[model samples]
Target: MGQKKRFLLRLDEKLYETVEKWSADELRSVNAQIEYLLTEAVKKAGRWKQEQGQSEKE
Candidate 1:
C-alpha cells in the first residue's frame, strides 16, 4: 500500500453518529468507511482512474 496522508476531520455530531452506525453495519471502521465513500464519489465524478488489471488503490 502507498503511504496515506492523514489529517484531522471535523464532522457534525449527527453526521458522525450516522457514519459510525453505517460503518458498523458494513463491518468497517469509521475511517475506512469515510475513505470508501470518498473513493466511490471520486469514481462517480469520473476523476478516478484504475490501473490496468489492478483494483483501485488508496
Candidate 2:
C-alpha cells in the first residue's frame, strides 16, 4: 500500500463549486474528484508515469 500525504490546496470559488457538483454527480468525494481530474488531465497530456519494464515483465 502507498502512503497518503496531506496538503492544503486553494481553488477559485466558481471552480470549487463546479467541482463540488461534478463530485456529487460522480458519487465521489471532492478530494477524489480533484484527484480524478488531475489524473485524467495528466493522461491526456501524456504526462502520466510508466512503470519500468512493465510491458516486458507482462
Candidate 3:
C-alpha cells in the first residue's frame, strides 16, 4: 500500500468539458486524467520520480 495525497483544482467550464471528453475517449476516469496530466507535467519539469515497483528489471 502507498500513501495518497489530495489537492483541489479549479477549471473553467469549457476546459472541464474538454477534459471530460478526453477522459471518455481514453477510457479514463476524470481523476485518472488529472493524475496523468500531473505526472506528465512533473516529468516534463524534471521533478517526477519513478517508483521502484514501476521500474523495469535490468
Query: Which structure among the candidates has the greatest TM-score?
Result: 1
| Per-residue lDDT over 1-58 for candidate 3, one digit per residue giving the tens place of the 0 to 100 score | 2777888989999999999999999999988998888878878899966667785221
Summed backbone clashes in each candidate are: 0, 0, 0
The TM-scores, one per candidate, come to 0.85, 0.79, 0.76
Q: lDDT order of candidates, best first?
A: 1, 2, 3
At residue 28, candidate 1 shows an lDDT of: 100
Pairs with steric clashes in candidate 2: none
TM-score of 3: 0.76
- Model 1: lDDT of residue 46: 98
What is the lDDT for 30 in model 1? 100
- Can you write out model 1's per-residue Cα lDDT over 1-58, one digit (the tens) per residue? 5689999999999999999999999999999999999989999999988777786653
Clash pairs for candidate 3: none
Question: What ranking of all candidate models by TM-score puts the best one first?
Answer: 1, 2, 3
- Relative to the true structure, candidate 2 reaches a TM of 0.79
Better of 1 and 2 by TM-score: 1
Which candidate has the top score in lDDT? 1
Off by over 4 Å in 2: 52-58
lDDT at residue 25 of model 1 (Cα atoms): 100
Instruction: Report the C-alpha lDDT of model 2 over 12-43, residue by residue, as the tens digit.
Output: 99999999999999999999999889978987
In candidate 1, what residue range of length 10 has the lowest lDDT sum? Answer: 49-58
Q: Could you tell me the lDDT of residue 21 within candidate 2?
A: 98
